[model samples]
Target: MEIFFCKSWFRAKKCPTEMWCEEQAKAAHEDGKPYTVLVGSIEQPYCFLEVTRRAVGVSFLDQLLRESLSYDFQEVEPGILFLTMATYREFEGDTGKVESGTSYIFGRDGAVTLRREFFNPQRLETSASSADVAANYSPKPEFGRYEDLIRVERSS
Candidate 1:
């Protein structure tokens, strides 16, 4: 097990020895505009070809059904993809909130966008402490052992 922290302003000023990895890919578009597509992964793969695939070629989440097919992704026919760890987090308070951490997913097509706090582990201020700042305050309590699961598929 391992712990990780976010690399934000607060985190940068306090701690300089943190690991935050980002993943990106070059997608070919029929329009000739090179689209940069990236996603978070939990494991390292031998090649990108093992992960990239088309919608018709791969399986996708049911929630993505309504998402614009032109921008969403699909799994590879063989169900092969990429895996990697994009970010990590630390305990912030008694409520189980993430006090400090870097969310690798963001932007329209970031590898690890969309942070949903389904379970409030901490009762800390949601606005007072920014994610980047919390990450800087202290290292993730037990992030050294946590593992993120990464899967790559064809860009829509």
Candidate 2:
């Protein structure tokens, strides 16, 4: 069976030109903010889930939440969340193919997490917003904001 790994992420804003991190790009241009600075392996098709399962005791989500604490969450619009899950695809003809495989966003409340499996790509689904997850998970303020990446790194 071809088991696919799911990569979940939240970007504060979509770049207008680059099509990703547009807000951050603008921030970099206007406020002189540094690169969002993703430290993970930029190599395409990197399996974070696999890495965590092999190297760490925590799950991928846990690692992500921990890392998110330092991202720039304040740049996003209030009440807006950009959640996405994508796979890595490589074709025989393509030399460099780390392009986003598939993704969906939860822009409203009451989104559904299909199959009840967080790692299942086919099971990854969303509603209009986070109301359902909030109701089901009984998320606290901290938990809700866990998705927010607003941490600003102070330069020495």
Clashes of each: 31, 14
RMSD of 1: 18.7
Candidate 2's displacement at residue 26, Å, is 16
Candidate 2 lDDT over 12-103, as tens digits, reads 22111122243543444344323222223332211122111111111121222222111111112333322222222222233222222222
What's model 2's TM-score?
A: 0.25
lDDT of 2: 0.24
lDDT of each: 0.24, 0.24
Worst 10 residues of 2 by lDDT: 50-59
Residue 25, model 2: lDDT of: 36
lDDT (C-alpha) at residue 28 in model 2: 43
Best by TM-score: 2
